[model samples]
Target: MKTTAAPGSPAGLLVLWTLTRTALLLCVLKVIVFPGPDVTSDVSVIYRGWYDVLSAGTFPQDDVTWQYPPAAALAILSPGLLPFLGYATAFFVLALVADLVTLALLLYAGRGPGRARRGAWVWVAGVPLLGPTVYARYDVMVTAVAVAALLAGVRHPRVMGALVGFGALLKVWPALLLVGVRRRGAWVSAVVTGAGVAVLFAVLMPGAFAFLTFQKDRGTEVESLGALVFHVARHHGWEGEVLLNYGSVEFLGPYVNWVSTGALFLTGAALVWLVVWRALARRLEPHTVADAAFVGVLLFTTTSRVISPQYMVWLVGLAAVCLCFRDSRMGAPVVLVLGACLVTVLEFPVWFAHVVASDALGVSLLVVRNGLLVAAAVLGGRRLWHATVPGWRGVAGVPGPAPAAETPVAP
Candidate 1:
C-alpha cells in the first residue's frame, strides 16, 4: 500500500473542492477581481433591485428583463436570509452553500453499490472553469435542486418529482428532468406540485405568469448557435446591430427573427426525436434516467435561441449525476460538455469584448464552444437511443435475432 493519499480519496477531493471554491468566492467577492466585465453587478445591481421589488409583495411586472418564472423571485430575495451581510455578499455566501450541497449529494450517490466517485470529481472541477459567474447568478442554486432530484430518481421518485417541479418554477429547464421517468407517481406528483405552485403564485402575486410574453420580440442572442449566422453576416454586410435587449446582448434587425424562428423549429424537432426515443425504448437501467436527461438538456440547450454562459452550470450538474453511475455511457458527452464550459468562460468575462465585436477572436470562440455543444448533443442522443432501444446493433437491411425478453427495473 502507498503512503500518499490517492487522487479521488474523500479527504483529497474535499481539499481540492475547498481550494477551488475559495478562489471562486474570492473572485465573486471582489477580493480578487476577475478579468473582463464585473460579473457580480447582476447580484449587486439587478438582483438587489429585484429583491426590493419582491419584498414589496409584487413581481417586477413592468421590467422586460424580469423574464423568469415567478418562483425566481424567491432566489432573488434569498439574500435576506443573511441580513448581517450586504446583499451581494449574502448572495455569494448562499451560492457557496448551494455548491457545497451539490457536492455532498454527488459524493453520497457515488458511494452506492457499483457507483464511482468520478461524478464528485466532475462537480469539483467543472464549476470553477466558468469562473466567478457561477456565484454571480442564481443558476447554481437552481442546479443544486436539480442534482438532488436526479440522484433521488430511482428510489425516491416522488421526491424527485416534487423537487423537479419546484426547480422548474425556479427556472423552467428543470422540467426536462422528467423526460425519462417511467413511474406514474413521479408524473402525478410533478403535475400536482407544479400546479399548486403556479396557482399559489398566481393568486398571491400580480403578473405571476408575465414571463410568458417577455420573449415574444426577443432576437438571437449574440452567444447562441444561431447568432453565429449574424456574426459571419456582419463581415459580409449583414447590417444587424448588436444591442442589449431583454437582459442579454443580442443581434437585432435584418434576418434576426428568421434565425430565431429557425432555432425554435430545431427545438421542436428535438422534442419529436425524444418522443420517438421514449416510445421505442425497451429497457431501463438505473443510470438510464440520468443519461436521458443529460441528452435531453443537451439537445435543447444547443438549439435554443440563447445559450448563456450560466446554462453550462445546468449541463455540468446533470453530467455529474450521470457519471455517478458506473454503467452510464455518457462519458464522451460529459467530456465534450466540460470542453464547452472551458470555452464558455473564455468567450464571456475574459475576452467577451472580442466576442461582441464579431471579430476573429470572438467568432472563433463561439464556433468552438457551440461546435462542442452540437457534437455532444448528437453523440449523447445517439448513445441514449442505442442503449435503451433494442435491436440497435442489427445490420442494415438484414434482420437479426429477436431480443430476449427482460424484466424492466422498477422505478
Candidate 2:
C-alpha cells in the first residue's frame, strides 16, 4: 500500500510503485498472449459479441437469450465497430481497463498496498475461474460502477448515486447500497441520483425505462445455481423438461416459484436481516461502513449462484477502502491482503481451469473455489463485525450501539 508518510515518505516508493505497475501490465500482456486471451474471464468479450449485434441497431430483443440486463447491451454497442480486431482482443482491452480502473479507484479512494495485495490475491484465486463467466461476461462493467460509487460515497454522495445507479442498471444487486446509506437525507440523495440516471437512460436509449421496469419477463439464467437443478434432474434420467425456472439466486427466486422460493427468500431475508442488524448496531462509522459494505458484497457473491469472477473486483476495491481507514488490528495490512490473494487464486485461476476442462476435476474445482470464497466472506464478515466494535467503544471514538452480547472483542 502506498502511504503518505508524514515528513519523509519512503524515498523509493514512487519508483517502486511505477516499476511494479509496469511489470504487472507486462505480465497481463503475457497472460493474454499465452492463453489466446481469456475472453471468458471478462464480460468484455460477451459485450463485444453483443456489440456485433448492436451495431446493426437492434436491441437484444430477447432473440438470442440476451442474458445480461438491457443497459449493458446498450453500453457496449460501440466496441463492435472494430470488426477487423477479434472479440478476444477487445475483451482483453476491457479487462485491462477494468483492472486499471479497479486499481485507480483503490488509490483514489485512499487504499494502499495492503488492499492492493488483497486484489492481487483475488486476481490469482480467480485466474482459474476466469473463463466464460468472467472474461466472456459483463460482471466487471457493473462491478466497476459499484466500486466507483463506494469510493465516491465518502466525499460525494451525488457522485456515489450515479455510479451506483449505473451499476444498478447493469445488474440489480448494486442497488443494495441504497439501503446501506444511513445518513439523514442520504436516502434522498441516492434517490435523486438514481432517478437522474433513470431519466438519462430514458433520454439516451429511449425505451430503457421499459427495459428497467419489466424485469419479471427475464427468464431464469441457467448459469446460476439453477444449472445445478438441470444437472441434478439429468442425473435422475428425467430428461423431459417442464418450464421450471429459478431466476437469479438472490431476488427473484423465492417470489417466483415453489421449490427454491422459500429457500431463496430465507437466504435473502437472512442477508437483509444481517445488513440491518449490522447497520442499526451503528457500527458503521465511515470506516466501518466501508468494511461492512465490502463484506456485504462478498456475502452477496458467495450466497448467490452468480459467482462471476470479475465480481471479485468489487470486493477488492471495497476492501481497499476498509484497509485505508487504519481499521485492522495488525498494524500490518498484509495479513488480509495475503488472505484475499489466496482466496482469489482459489476462486479464479483454479476455477477457470475447471470450467475450461468441463470434467470431474473441473466440477470439483468450481466447488472448492466457491467454498473458499464462502469461507472468506464468513471470516471476513466476522472480522469486520468485531472490528466495528471493540469492548467499550465501537470504533476508536464511536459509541457502541449493539448489545454487549454481540461483541467478540474486549476494549
Candidate 3:
C-alpha cells in the first residue's frame, strides 16, 4: 500500500529549501534590502580584498582583519570559478551551492534506517531564521563541510576525519567535531591530514600562520556572554567604550581585559568537563558521537570571548546532526539552539546599533540569546552524562543498567 508522505517529507523539504534559499539569495544579492546594515559588504569588500592579496600568491600579511586560517583563501578565491559573474554575485551563488550540499547530506542521512527527517527540517528552517547572514558569510560553506563530516562519521570514520581536518583549516571551530569520536583511524587521519595541510601551506605561503598572533589582543565582543557585564556596567558608569577591535566590535576599556580573561577561563573549564566525560562514558553509541560533539561546541561557544551571529551557523549544523539519530537525547537543547538562532539575528544586523550602544533593547536581546545558549549547554551536558555515564538514570529518568552482578565460582 502506498502511504502519502508527510509535509516534511524529502520532496516537501526540498521545495521549502528552494523557496527559502531563493529568498536568502535575493537578500544577499541586494535585490531585496534586508533590514539593518548591508551584510554582503563583508564578501564584496573584505573577502574581495583578501582574494586580491591571496591571488598575488601571498596571505594578507599586513591586514589585521585577515584573521582566518590559510584554507580560507580557497573560499575567497572560489568565486573566481565563475568569473563571468561578478565576485559578490558568484560568492552568493557558491554559498547557496554549499547550502544545497548540506541539505542533500541531511536528506540522505534521514532516509537511513532508524534515522528521522527532523534534521532536514531543522536545517531548512534554521538557516533562514538567521536571515541573509547565512549566505553573506563564508561560515555556511564551512558548515556544509561540518554537516558532511558528522553524517559520515558513523560509517566512514576516515572520511569524517579527513573532512574535519580540512574544515578546521577553513575555520577553527570544526575541530570540536572530533570531541566525541572514538575511532583511532579518525584520530590518525585527522592528525596526518592536518599536519600535511599545515606543512603545505607553510611551504607555499608566507605568513600562513599569522592568524595565531592576531588573536592575542582580542577584546570581548559586544555580543559575547561576558559582554553582558559591560552592557550592564554602562548603565552604572563603568567607564568602558565599545570599539571595533580586530574584526569584531568589542568592549575596549576598563576591566574589558578581565572579562576576556574570565571568558577564556570558562572555556578552559569546559575543556576539562569534556575530558572528564570522555573518561567516564561507557555507553558509546553511533548517536553519542553527534550528541557529545553538540554539547562540546555549545560549551565552547557559550564561553567564547566573541559570540558572533554567524557562530550560530555552526551550532545549528551540529544540532541538526544530533536530531538525525532517533536515540539522540538532544531534542531540548536543539530547540534552545533554534530559539537562540532567531534571537541572534535580532541582536545582530537588525538591532546591532542598539547592541553596540548597550541600550535596554539590546541588553534584553543579548540576555535572551545568550541565556538560551547557556541553558542549552547545561541541559545538553546533563543529558549526555546521564545517557552515557554508568549508574545514572538516562533521559526521562529511565534507569541505566546496573553493573553486572559478580557470580561466585568454585576456586
Candidate 4:
C-alpha cells in the first residue's frame, strides 16, 4: 500500500533517513570500525560454525549450541550460499535486510491517518533506539516475520498461517500471534500450517527437536524480570555465582532453578489468562488482533526467565504494529514499551559491566527497565481488556457505550 504522505514530507523523510542513517552507522561500527569480541563475533561463531556443517550436507547433530528449531538452519546455512561474503558480514547484512523489511512494513501500516499514522514513526525510531543490538541477533528477522504475519492476518488467512508457521520455525514466540486470529478458519489454517512445516523439518533434520530438550534446563538470565529475585537476593547474603551459562549471563546457585520454574508457571498462567480473555470478550476488532498479540508477547517476555537485551526488539516491533490501528488503545503502553527499549540498550551494551558486577548502577538500571516493563504489561493488559471486554466500565457506574467508535477495518 502506498502512503498518502509524500516521500519528501517532513514526517516521511525524517523517519526514512533516521532508519537509514542508524543502519548505515551500525554497519560501519560493527563491520569495519569496531574490533572486539562483540555480538557480531557471537553470531559469527554460531552461524559460521554451523555453516561448515551445513556445507558438508549434514545437520549439526552433535552441536549442543545449535539450540534452535530446525528451520533456523535456513538462516544459519544461508551465508554459505554467499560464498564470497565473510560469515560475520553476511550475518550483519542479512539482519540489516530484516530490519529494513520490518521498518517498511511499519511505515506501510502507518499510512492511515491521525495517531494511526504514527505507527511508522514509532517503528522507524524504535529499532535504532535499540542501538547496536538491532543487527546483532536473528530475532530481528523473526520480528520481520511477525510484522508481515500481523499485517496479513486481516485479509489473507492462509498467508498469515504460512508466515506464522515459518516464523515459529525460527523462534517459538511468533506462534503466540495465532491466538489473536479472529476467524476459526484462520486459526485452523495457522495451526495446520505451522504443524506441517515443523513435521517436515523434523523428518529432514536430525536435531530438529534438540532445542526443546536443551531449553528446559536454561538458567535465569540476569536481564529477565524473574531474575530480579536472585539479583536482589545476592545483596542480602545469597551465595550464588554469576556466570555465562548456556549462552547467557545467569544466576546459578541454590533456589535459582526454582525461580526459573516459578517463571514458567507464571508464563503458563499468562497463557491461560489470554485464552480466557479471548473467550469472554464479545468482539474481535481487526486492530485488536495486533493489540492482543502485543499483550500476549508482553506477558511471555516479561515473565520469562531469560530476557536478553535484544528481546526488547520483539516488543518494540509489535507495539509499533499495534499502534497502526485507528482504534488501537495501546497508545500509552506503547510509549512505556519504547522507553523500556532505550533503557534496555543502556543497561546492556553501555553499562553491561555494571550489570555483570551487580552493583548499584546495574541494579538501578534493572529497576528502571524492569519497572517500565511491569508498568507496560499492566497498562497494556488494562487497555486491551477494557477495549475488548464489554461492560467493563459499567461496573464502575460509568456505563452507556463508553465513548468509543466502531473498530477500524484493516487496510
Clashes of each: 0, 38, 0, 0
Runs with alpha carbons beyond 4 Å of true place in candidate 3: 1-6, 395-411
lDDT of 2: 0.49
lDDT of 3 at 16: 85
- By summed lDDT, the worst window of 10 consecutive residues in model 3 runs over 402-411
Candidate with best TM-score: 1
Q: Model 4: runs farther than 4 Å from truth?
A: 1-11, 14-37, 112-115, 393-411
Which model is ahead, 2 or 4, in terms of TM-score? 4
For each candidate, what is the lDDT? 0.91, 0.49, 0.88, 0.77
lDDT of 3 by residue, 1-411 (tens): 753444656777878898899999999988898888889889999999988989988998889888988888899999999999999999999999999998888888887677998998999999999999998899999999999989888888999999889888999888998888878888888778878888889899898988888988888999999999999999998987888889889998999889999999999999999999988877777788899889999999999999988999999999998899887889999999999999999987999999998988999999999999999999999998987776665446634444443212100
Ranking by lDDT: 1, 3, 4, 2
The 10 consecutive residues of candidate 4 with the worst lDDT sum are 394-403
lDDT, candidate 1, at 212: 90
2 versus 3: better TM-score goes to: 3
RMSD of each: 2.5, 7.3, 3.9, 3.7
lDDT of 1: 0.91
lDDT of 2 by residue, 1-411 (tens): 765632222323334434444444444445534233243433333455556666665555543335445466544753454567666555545654665566556544444532333332333333222333333445656666776776677667666766666676676677765445655444566667667766665565533534434444433332333334443444455433324232222213322244244335645964875665555454445554455566666666656544544565555555555565554422222234334444444435544443433345544544545555556666665555555534434544333455453532110
Residue 270 of candidate 2: its Cα lDDT?
Answer: 46
Better of 1 and 3 by TM-score: 1
Off by over 4 Å in 1: 1-5, 393-407
All candidates' TM-scores?
0.96, 0.66, 0.95, 0.90
